[model samples]
Target chain A: MEFSLIDRIRERTAQARDDVRLGIGDDAALLAVPAGQELAVAIDTLVEGVHFPRGTAAADIGWKALAVNLSDLAAMGATPAWALLALTLPNADADFIDGLATGFAQLAQPYRLALVGGDTTRGALTISVAVHGFVPAGKALTRTGAQVGDLVMVTGTLGDAAAGLRLVQQGGQDDPRSAWLIERLNRPVPRIAAGLALRDCASACIDVSDGLLADLGHICAAGAVGAQIDASLLPRSSALLDWFDDDASLDFALSGGDDYELCFTVSPQKLAATQAELARLGCGATRIGRIVAGEGVCVRDRDGRQRATARPGWDHFAA
Target chain B: MEFSLIDRIRERTAQARDDVRLGIGDDAALLAVPAGQELAVAIDTLVEGVHFPRGTAAADIGWKALAVNLSDLAAMGATPAWALLALTLPNADADFIDGLATGFAQLAQPYRLALVGGDTTRGALTISVAVHGFVPAGKALTRTGAQVGDLVMVTGTLGDAAAGLRLVQQGGQDDPRSAWLIERLNRPVPRIAAGLALRDCASACIDVSDGLLADLGHICAAGAVGAQIDASLLPRSSALLDWFDDDASLDFALSGGDDYELCFTVSPQKLAATQAELARLGCGATRIGRIVAGEGVCVRDRDGRQRATARPGWDHFAA
Candidate 1:
């Protein structure tokens, strides 16, 4: 049973990685880290109903499972190289494995990421992926480096995934706008290239998995500084703006989770260069705010008055 | 929610590892792999009711979750280092986290295995652990190097965990023998010292998670060799021997899973040195078989006659 499942998953997710001395089918994978590099690792798990609604397509589950972890590497300015997956399911289904593996391989192939090792078990549907990447020593982007007066920037749009989740939950999928938003929720594009572009210049970096306010709050907490973002400047896709009112869009942009975009800080001096680097990758940055000498993230309205703080983002254990 | 969970886990699992540049507070972990060493990675998942009994202590679950993955690293002759945990629980209960984290830390502390990063999600009770370890380049043990004349030896005793599992299912835990057996089931040691000892000499190695015959069969399959074992020579713990008859004990020793002991092949030329190496580590090995020229594993009776093959090991996805 184990052999067959591994064979099937391998058939779909196979990639040639010269550094992976031994890939799947081994007790543990052996990988060689290139000289003069630090290894950046990240792991995330997706559970049915909790991470995604029940009956979500297996392919989507697989794609999102890997995307979220790769998003972490992207947040760290790491080049993804290998991943290990632990998939738990109600039972071993060939078609499910095929779809999931295909989806995983689809996202992994562009980065030359190899599925090194994984375990499959019978249980509630859960997928855990651990990613390993390479970054030159001393150059990893971290959340503790934000300084006062640094410009706060974000890659791509923010509220599309949150809007997508809302439309899917409301059964409002008839419109093309809904379709686009739903795709954002189901398939978040990890900004790996943007992370690379920001590595040299970004003062601080984090991936927005939880809403912008909550994740930015992490940067604030780490650096012992605060951030003030203008709500009027939050980036939102056209589809999201067309589907929701201004107030709703603003709220979603501030607190909608599942946007796998990079929220980073850059010294004011490097703003133009950072913007140019990101532009070359076609994922331009939007200046939403600046680092300030305070605590916790503060959102300012169009009138420059602070908005009343809402519950930051979706809390997995919130009552 | 994520911060609190991380803080709790970090408080319990913290170790002063200078190589971990950044840990749980960031988007991902940055770990410096030692110069001239390759990284070995392994992942495993445990689900309530499937991997362990529903009422199993959170501590045991925690210990076993990390232990099983460490067992994989042990199979590769790697020195354990950092780990990432993705925990899925039905609800956020403080006491459960305390017990689980305490248990996980208890096992991890001895190895100085730091918990670097992870995700906590809401779902059916499950724990997935990914371990990263370092092995000197080109010296890591693998399953594909066995020769036809190599001796098949296993670290420590077998059948105790399997026997213990049987006793628990039968509600026979009132006996001291049952108590010892259950402990074996709950906390099977991942013979790190034995693995290190075998690194220089063992031709092939695998961890006996799915019973010895089944796991040794993996070595055979990898090296395209066969094996023959004598039932009479199989090692069984005193508690296992005292509680079960010869036939039952032999069956458990042969096909009982979750042992987490190393089953490896050593050449005849290195037998004395290998024995001395393991004896020094206090996890003495016993030789029960040898690799042969052809096909699947064959069992031999005490009388030197062929015995019929039984079904091999536990299959997680068996229908």
Candidate 2:
């Protein structure tokens, strides 16, 4: 029965990738990484209630599972190559598996990422994805290279997913604009191309999985620098602005997580090229702030006054 | 709090490996796969109640979680390199985490397997491990090469784990030999050295996680051949024999899972060398069966008569 389910998944996710010497069936997958390229690997796990709402669609869960891991690769400026999924389901629900494979394939097809191997078990619903990508030696972006005075930039709008979550929790399912926000929450686009373009220009990079303020704080800690973001400069989707007050939307943009957008630091000299390159990729870059000489992350109002927040962002254990 | 836990884990498992350009604390780990080597990747998930009993020790869980993934690499004749762990717990318990990390480090230190990068989440306890290893190009043993008349072999004694599990389930924890059986269940050693030695000689190889009969059946199905095991020749540990009668012990040997031992097929010409090589590795190899002209797996009793069993092995969904 397990074999049959594996066969079903294999049939659905079949693709022609020569680099995958062996796919799903074997005890372990055989992959050939191009010579001189380093392999970038990341893993993330999503539980039914903790990561997503209890009743979230399996298709959305599948997409988000791979997207989160791919976002990690994107933050590293690596080109995704293969993924291994370890799926735990409450039962063998064929429809759920079909929906999940469809969603996973939809995102994977764009990057040509192969589902090389995985395991399925009977348990509480949990999805774990480990992605492998290739980055040219000495070229991967990291969160420890930000220097004082570097511009902190982000790709795409923030607060949409957080607003979407708010609408979801408030039972705003019938709102016409809710679809747009919910889509942001359910299907996030990993900034892979923008990351690749910023590989040489960006001094430091990270994905906004823990909200902008919290994630940027990581950069500050890693590079032993500080950052100050202008609240008014934060990018928010039209839907986010329309659904909430200015202050509420700004708060979400500041500390609401699950955006999956790339937040990077670029030196002033490379700012123009970085902006133009990301613009060409269709996810225009937004300059939010600058790396400073102090410690931790600070947010300033449009008038340049420091603003206080109750807390920076979500911490799974703390919450 | 999450960061502190991660720091604790990183400090405990720290090792200096030059190939690991970037380890934990990065968005993604950067690893260099030596030129002319293929990467072998495998993932496995262990959930509470499903993979292990409810009261199992955290240390045992951690050791088994990694051991299972390493066994997958061993089946492919790959030397362990690095591992990514995604640990989901009911809550953040420092003592539990410490115990688990200790168990994991105990197994990993021998192979020099570095704990690279991973995620920790809040949910029902689950440990998903993805292991990365390197095998020389074209040397990976797979399940597709078994030819007619190949000698079927397995490493280490079988059914001890199964017997151990039975004892645990039957409330025999206080028995004189229960500790020995329970140890087998908790810390089944992966035969990495034996698998490495069999790389050149074995036609097909797989790890026995789903009982000898079920796992061997996979080899037959993949190679499109048949197999017949001589029941009398099946290797049983003294503990398993002392715990159960001949019939029960033989049944456990054939269909009890979680052995984490390698099962391989070698041509008659390589049989002697394979046995000698594995014996030198200290685990030794046992010849229990051979590839036949037909399909499926059959077991012959001492009188050379075919014996029928109720089922092959454990299937998550089917069970």
Candidate 3:
């Protein structure tokens, strides 16, 4: 079974870049990184009953597996290069592995990332993807460069994924809007272009996989500064708000994760430049907060009431 | 359990690098590449019951999990930089996770790799480590560069892992030398230093994980040459021959997998230089064969008899 599944995966991965000197059949895949470019790498794992609901579509699982890792490269402002896949499934079904690999290859085609070396084994359904990308040495965006007086901004909408998960949890699977939200949860459009465009203007950046407040906390902690978020400034799609009540929806927006939005900081002096840059890139950027001179994070409502946010984040080892 | 395990991993990774601006605590690790270097990245996954035996020691498995990916970096002739660990366990246990993290931290410290971003979820025990290293652009080692007259060399001994697995399968726990073979099986070292030294002299390089014959077959297939292996040149520890008869043990030595040694090729003219450089680095190099103008690999006995080598290499998807 493992054998047949591997064959299917290998067949599916036959489409790759010319620079992939060695692909699936070797101990490790060999790739040709372009000269003068640093490779950016990131790995993400999704497990049954944890990262996704049981019985999720295999294709979506495959898509999410690559999507999340690509999101990391996007946050780093790097161009995609190559990827390695590690998959563990209960039984090796040729069709299922091929389906998953097909989804991955399709998504990777646009970015020119070649499928390289990987391993397959027997276990619960687990997909781990390690993706490599290229960026000029000094241009790889990091979380340490943000300053105290920078404007905190996010690309795209938030809370859709968290709300989508809730809807799936409640067994709400048939709404028209549910498709959009579920797609947001399952197939996030990694803001690769927006991140690259903001590379020069943004002080620091992160991919929002752990909610807005918590992810912003990372930038703040890395920069050793405080952050103040205006709840009114958070971006929301009408599709998200129409499905749930105001407070519940806002809660989802504040603490919900899996957004894959690029939350970043741009200096006050670079605001005009950043706005112009985003316009040229045809992406939306909303200023939701500001980096401050203190420590910790604070959020305030439009009515001047302080909004209390629990540690609304995912902890893998919290029993 | 996940939170504290991550904390322990965080504490253990402090020796990684100052350029790792944010490590272990962020959504994604932030790093700064050196001014004029490219990054090489690789990922590997190990699953309980599939990749390792049941009831394997947590410490050994942890060490091996990082070691295998490090071996990939070595194959690329990249110096280790940073690593991200994605660990999945059936149930969260602080002691087990801490012990595993301790093993990984201990191995990573010498390589200057830091624990970066990771994801934890509930599932069968699996560890997927994605490692990043650095090399100057256009100088990374590859499998396609081996020329027709290159001398193929291997680092360290081979087949002890197969012998060790035999003992474990037979439930033999009392041989005076049994521990040595068993430890070899449990902890295969990655020849990072040897791989680094071979970067300049080696035309093509690969790590011997899936048996020497099968792995070198990868180089031959990629380099479009046939290899003539000297069976007598195969390295086998004396302890590995204590129980098995000569023919059986020799067969194991020729085709056994899980020996994580470096198999590389250098031009015949550079053979003496290769030996001198390896000696300077205190690494063992055994000339096992030479590449010829054909394709595939053939192993010949001392008298030049064509010996039959059973294909015992691992195939990830083979039934």
Report the C-alpha lDDT of model 2 over A99-175, residue by residue, as the tens digit: 78778877888788888878888888889999999999989999999999999999999988889988988988678
lDDT of each: 0.89, 0.89, 0.79
TM-score for each model: 0.98, 0.98, 0.85
Candidate 1 per-residue C-alpha lDDT over A60-155 given as tens digits, one digit per residue, 9 for 90 to 100: 888999999999999999999998888999977888887887788779878888888888888999999999999999999999989999999998
For model 2, name the residue pairs that clash. Answer: none
- TM-score of chain B in each prediction: 0.97, 0.97, 0.95
Residue B42's lDDT in candidate 2: 93
Residue A290, candidate 3: Cα error in Å is 4.6
Clashing pairs in 1: none
lDDT of 3 by residue, A1-319 (tens): 4335445545655564765655655444545656556557667889988888886777788888888989988898888877777788887676687778776766776786676666777788898887777777667788777788889998888899999999999888677768899889888878888878878888899999988887888888889998998988889888789898878788888888899999999988888888888878888889998999987778899887889897656765555
Name the lDDT value of residue A140 in candidate 2.
Answer: 97
Predicted chain A of candidate 3: TM-score: 0.95
Q: What is the descending TM-score order?
A: 2, 1, 3
- Give candidate 3's fnat, 2 decimals: 0.35
- Supply the TM-score for candidate 2: 0.98
DockQ values of all predictions: 0.86, 0.87, 0.33
Q: Candidate 2's fnat?
A: 0.95
Candidate 1: residue B145 Cα off by (Å): 1.5
Q: What is the lDDT of candidate 2?
A: 0.89
Location of the lowest summed lDDT over 10 successive residues in candidate 2 chain B = B1-10
Each model's backbone clash number:
0, 0, 5
TM-score of chain A of each: 0.97, 0.97, 0.95
